[model samples]
Target: MLQRSPKDDTGDFLFHFSSIKIYNEHTLVAAPMGSGVYVRHKEGDWEGLRQGMPEDVHVNRLIIQTGKLFACTNKGLFEFDMICELWRDTGLVIGCYQLREAGGQLWAATPYGLWSRTGTGWHKIAYSHVRVYDFLFYPEFIILALEFGIAVYDRLVGVWMEFPFNEAVTGLAVFEGHILGVTENGTLLHGDKQGGFEQIRFPHLFLFSIVTKGSEVYACSDRGLFRISCIRDQITLISVRLGCPVTDIDCNADNLYMATLFQGIQRLEL
Candidate 1:
């Protein structure tokens, strides 16, 4: 188990981390506001790998595609060069918020729109007006949780479908065989393509992100981390109250990492 605070660790290096992404079982990356990126290589140690990045960079999201590390930041889409241990811009001028890998491509959620990168170029697929907060990918469709509602992109028909909700959405996930979304006010919503959305009475916290492990669903908010379970269309909070304002969460089979607004990154034994 890792200690909560190590003595050799200085405050300057562990800046306010926003996101955590695990590339493999033992490798992970932490995105910080001003400290570029910190990569935990396997089980050995964590190293700073921001040789060419800006000193005051805000890495909003981190993702891995084709065995390479990529970051979504205020600048644009960046790919980490493992050879030289530096970050290279992918020429996409996007102030991105979230990133996902689907259909052999990289999808980025930005204020402008949702951009997809297949080869070397980026293309705007849909939702040019709605500001996207998060995204989820399934076999037949892509769900994008917008600032106001949720948008579904039908891959078979090559069209977009809208499920409008009045409340602003903060996160999206595929849970319990349904499309699930969390509102800014921490209400859990399940979407039906023909029936619209129904609000689940979970909690009234400001939820930011949602992740899943097996059948269990986890949500992070200003209050803490909550474990939710959905059975027979009824959602129940199984466990909660972990750490402060968890901005992002990622986990492997053995360990889970949480990134907070103030506490850098916290490791939990799973």
Candidate 2:
């Protein structure tokens, strides 16, 4: 069963949820299309925690690293302090699309290229002209979903490589030990750091995001929520109706969270 979030600020159901992040086992934070951010604790109501944040800045993405919460917006990256319930600037003020923490370092993906944190400061690493949408972190490599193709940054060898798929990949995931790419045209592509990427034929899917829990992978698309399962040598996809387009999907231990285009948040039992 899907349950409504106890307290959503958009009483008129006009707010479109842009992104959601699982802060902890008991808390979750979400970014609305035009609002700052909202938080929900265990069995509590959703409330705004926008203090110390810029007024009317659109927050596009959220992530938690080492028990600290971070939000990427049109202005810059802001860190949320749990103790004060306030936000602090991280000083990479640009058009950031996504944020990731790998190798105990924070990485910012932007149109100006990629930036990584070293010691206490951030420095540019790669791609000044290309826009990166997502990342898949492995122990030895970081795979990026770029505007034109997939790029791999090898941490062990300190080398950069590119795989041009000629398709605009919107999302990336590591499922069953393979790098999966979700293209804007609704095709699924898989590849490894060594070999090349190949397409997986399925019904045209308008997917926006992809997430994995254990062996199961879930995708949020215009049609609904889909579960991708691989049994033996066969791949199966099952769609669940949401009656609304899903923009983002996330999961905790016991529940799956779906942020909709205009319906706020929907909680489903895991």
Candidate 3:
């Protein structure tokens, strides 16, 4: 059941949330840290969807690829079975941090390495021992935010390139044909095609996640949710304060979903 409490002055709901993702078209899935995953269909109340998952499973991220919903958790990767009303483990067994789709394939980022599903088996692509925080798919390369630096994998040449960064990147997104990244110390960086990055001034600090929608890039930070415009050569930022710290954010055609540190999930009209 979805807990209802008094809203703050900024109209923010009060519930702990770890991440949020849009499922299918009308369904909203949210992970409230240790409480497991919950689903809300169209104007319906949120319902827990932890039937087949392990007890107290901690989901780190949620993603939809090829019309199927997947959850990255501490136990491993699990695919939601809509027909069965439960989650089935994908048998990857290693802890997954994030899941992404690029080059018409599903990719999983884990502490062990980056793995991809091929046929009925999973293959390791890169980053065997390094930890990957996030990744983005460029034109011909797969860009990764690793524990210590940035890595770019060229698909056409079948080569991997790495560039060291002073601070660890916690999130990644692409804007206006340039790579944008948020570092662990809350610095926003803009990178070119050659893997060189330059710092851009960002007001809010302690940013954890970032996502791009259309010509705008939204970043989640301790202060609030900052929306950056990618329209002009110079970056512009607009802060949307919800009176709480935001941890993650996602968007679709109609709505922008925010996962807050103390609030469960808030949906805003775009």
Candidate 4:
């Protein structure tokens, strides 16, 4: 990615991985550290959705649901329309956070609250005094990973329950019938679908991003990309020669894409 004028003057690698989302018809959207969301169509790559982004704000999350792509930044949430080839000003907004699509709507874990996005508008489903660092969604509940521990909200019971781990939970992902969480110490939690978490054999490195699909769990920490079993019981290492920190990692049907501090998007055939 050719950068025009850099954002951070001293930060040599001006970009990082902010968000990774898979879209319909096999389209994938990646919001890397620098400027915009790079859209991958089929086996090709393009960075068209990044136009008209806020200059002062950096994209924190990317979500694709119901054929639309969304970018969450410090300024707010912006929606990109695929059919129209432009960004729709639907007034959906959120602060710094992560996002994932579930069921029929999109969920964002913002600093001040948890917001849900449908075709209608943005609505707050939950709010907290402290920031919500990350979240995971299953068929029955939404697991909010916070600075404290884990908060489970039951969709069927209309009740919210929290288990205070008393430590910062940084990353969240799910595979098979298991929920995997990465702590600040890079400790991982493997939980059954019906219950809570139990510590597993996660690496002891500093972690920044994680994603899981099928039987694979991928994590990006200060070290590099770590591949684990679906249960996080076994781990494998994939070294990255890219100078900057590993930003995010994701895989699709044909390729595994990784974004580094400012290396744009690196694609490897699966």
Candidate 5:
């Protein structure tokens, strides 16, 4: 959700929003690529939430866990202190790409590897040398989208199983017991936990993010937004072009929100 700051009357616009999230039912928070984080209430102007953060920090992702806002940024992992109205650095100073909560624990994907936060501090769990992009929990397994392929950690066995892929994966989602992943080159993949992934053809190129809502899966790309439907063994793609490059997308029960590369945030009514 990039735009001119509320105080900027010069008509200059900011671009390249990386992530967006609907928070607390009435607030919308967005992370611009290099401008830290911003928040906006319903129909209100966007406000910066950059206190205690470095100037021009790159925020890659945002997540709400335990009713608190956490940001994955170039500097480190930050938790927003509502009382102080500032972001508190959690002391994990690596470049974090994504954040997730599974089994009541907080996890972060980074260039170094996959890390989990404990009551003590952050610990590198696995893939110490590989870059992790995204992750999701499936039953007792933790599925990760890594630079080379998908890796599933069998919690019961305490070992990691690798599923080799040709392209680097950027995002992942689960739908109806199947794992769906979008590659950096715009390829959509579907497979089970056993690592048998097959490409699902779609027209969009340069996919940036993937998300799921109810029974539907949505992927945002340079072309626009696409809705994927999986019924029985048939897969369907429905395109809803917004005339701009959509970098990220999320949805709730009443609306769908999109963060475009240059067009700020777009909202679609449900």
Candidate 6:
């Protein structure tokens, strides 16, 4: 069992681990914010940082690289140094939505376009005409989720191919060739890069966040949270209260971490 820390705690706020990066130290850094971020050494170890940050700013997303934490804030891009205990402002684009590491590089979703960091520089991932939301890279291709729908980035052809998703995407998670996307009105949209998309039918799930443990995919919905197997095809209720407007859902090898709008953060023993 992990001991809880006084400072590393949460109240009533939405928490979703839509993005996670594990360090060499086994410390998992998660972006639990739709408008901010935090780091924890373990459960009950929440530390509010923005320590050396210049002013009050809201960070939408974050990514970790080279033993440092990087984020796109309302002000601009920033890197957090744990050793020096300081926040270094990158001062790049001010309108960034999300960040991910792919193909030995860091990729961020900016209002301008998709920005990729290679070594010490950043170049735009040109899309003909679209605002990219979320992305996941595989050995073969890269998948991008947008407001319009879900698309795949072809590194070979240098083009984007939009998959036939007819609804707006709220959140997405990639596992192998399959991508799980949550849509409005409590529907789960899943698509395979090789095959096509197939909606997994369930009860009244509010559809907030999507998470995966091995091949088991979990969904946070208004009605409640449900866990479904990739091959077994069984939808099991995880939690009802923890499902509504759920902010962050993260796991540390064992046990579960959940953050909700009404509930600050909840830990499940199993």
Off by over 4 Å in 6: 1-47, 54-56, 65-67, 155-159, 164-167, 184-186, 192-195, 199-203, 213-215, 231-244
Each candidate: RMSD: 2.9, 2.8, 3.9, 4.9, 2.4, 4.5
Candidate 4 vs 6: which has more TM-score: 4
Return the TM-score for candidate 6, rounded to 2 decimals.
Answer: 0.73
lDDT for every model? 0.75, 0.78, 0.79, 0.67, 0.81, 0.61
Tens-digit per-residue lDDT, 18-133, candidate 4: 66666774776777665666666765635447565666567776655565677777667778766667665546555756777777777777777677877777777785477786
Q: What are the TM-scores, per candidate, against the unseen true structure?
A: 0.84, 0.86, 0.87, 0.74, 0.90, 0.73
TM-score ranking, high to low = 5, 3, 2, 1, 4, 6
Q: Which stretches of candidate 3 lie over 4 Å from their true place?
A: 1-15, 200-204, 230-232
lDDT of 6 by residue, 64-132 (tens): 555668876666678887788667866465566667666667777765667887766777775525666
Q: Model 5: clashing residue pairs?
A: none
lDDT of 6 at 10: 50
Clash tally, candidates in order = 0, 0, 0, 2, 0, 12
Best by TM-score: 5
lDDT per residue as tens, model 5, 1-270: 334466555553355677888888888899877888888888778888989988778888888787889998888889999899999988788988888787778889999889998998899988879999998877788889999988888889888888877778878888678888888778888884455888866654667778776677887878888787766676666786657888777678888888888778888888
Q: What is the lDDT of candidate 6?
A: 0.61
Poorly placed runs, candidate 4 (over 4 Å):
1-30, 38-50, 83-85, 118-120, 192-204, 230-244
Q: Please identify which of the two predictions, 1 or 2, would achieve the higher TM-score against the true structure.
A: 2
Output the lDDT of residue 14, model 1. Answer: 53
Per-residue lDDT of candidate 1, residues 7-62 (tens digit): 23765465677778887566778877656788776655567777767657778778
**Which regions of candidate 5 deviate over 4 angstroms?**
1-13, 192-194
Error of 4 at 221 (Å): 1.7
Global Cα lDDT for candidate 4: 0.67
